[model samples]
Target: MATEKLGIRVERNPPESRLSELGVRQWPKWGCEKSKFPWTYSAKETCYLLQGKVKVYPDGAGGGEEDFVEIAAGDLVVFPKGMSCTWDVAEVVDKHYKFE
Candidate 1:
């Protein structure tokens, strides 16, 4: 069966941590609890996860009907503008994010 995938782009554990430095320079760091949450992006966002792991699914997706993406420490993720998704945070997370 074919499955739909969220339009998030991820660079896993990027080399030299370039994403980390860019994120920190662009925005203030943010932290979140270990939990599941729903979110909609009003503006495009690019983020670097400093710590923790997460599984994110696009809206209205479940039961293995759609593909989800994982973002973890040292990962660089880009959430497109106007995208809506759910986040399953497996651990407390610290990230630096910037919106455009």
Candidate 2:
């Protein structure tokens, strides 16, 4: 019997270019409490939840409010380009993100 390995393509930006183009920004410290933070969307962003839960609100013009979507551990969230939103963290959470 023969088995073939599963293959996947992964693309990464150049470290030097990434560092130069996008300098390191401070990540907010979260705790087991409700917290809201404003964020501007650019290009696109992919996020993976590692711990806790959070709600993302997409920017909307209706009374300065937006739609909310909940995300939790083992969840993948994608925010498309030109989307402005706010992150409402209900519990202490940590996530890994990739932005383009």
* Top candidate when judged by TM-score against the true structure: 1
Writing each residue's lDDT as its tens digit, candidate 2 over 10-88 gives: 1223244443353322323223456888877666765545577776666663433334666676554556677776778
How does each model score on lDDT?
0.79, 0.54
lDDT of model number 1: 0.79
- Which pairs in model 2 have colliding backbones? none
Candidate 2 — which residues are off by over 4 angstroms?
A: 1-34, 61-66
Tens digits of per-residue lDDT, candidate 1, 1-100, equal 1122467888776765575457455677888999998899999988888898999988755538456887889777889898888899998899988888
- RMSD of each candidate? 4.4, 11.1
What lDDT does candidate 1 reach at residue 52? 89
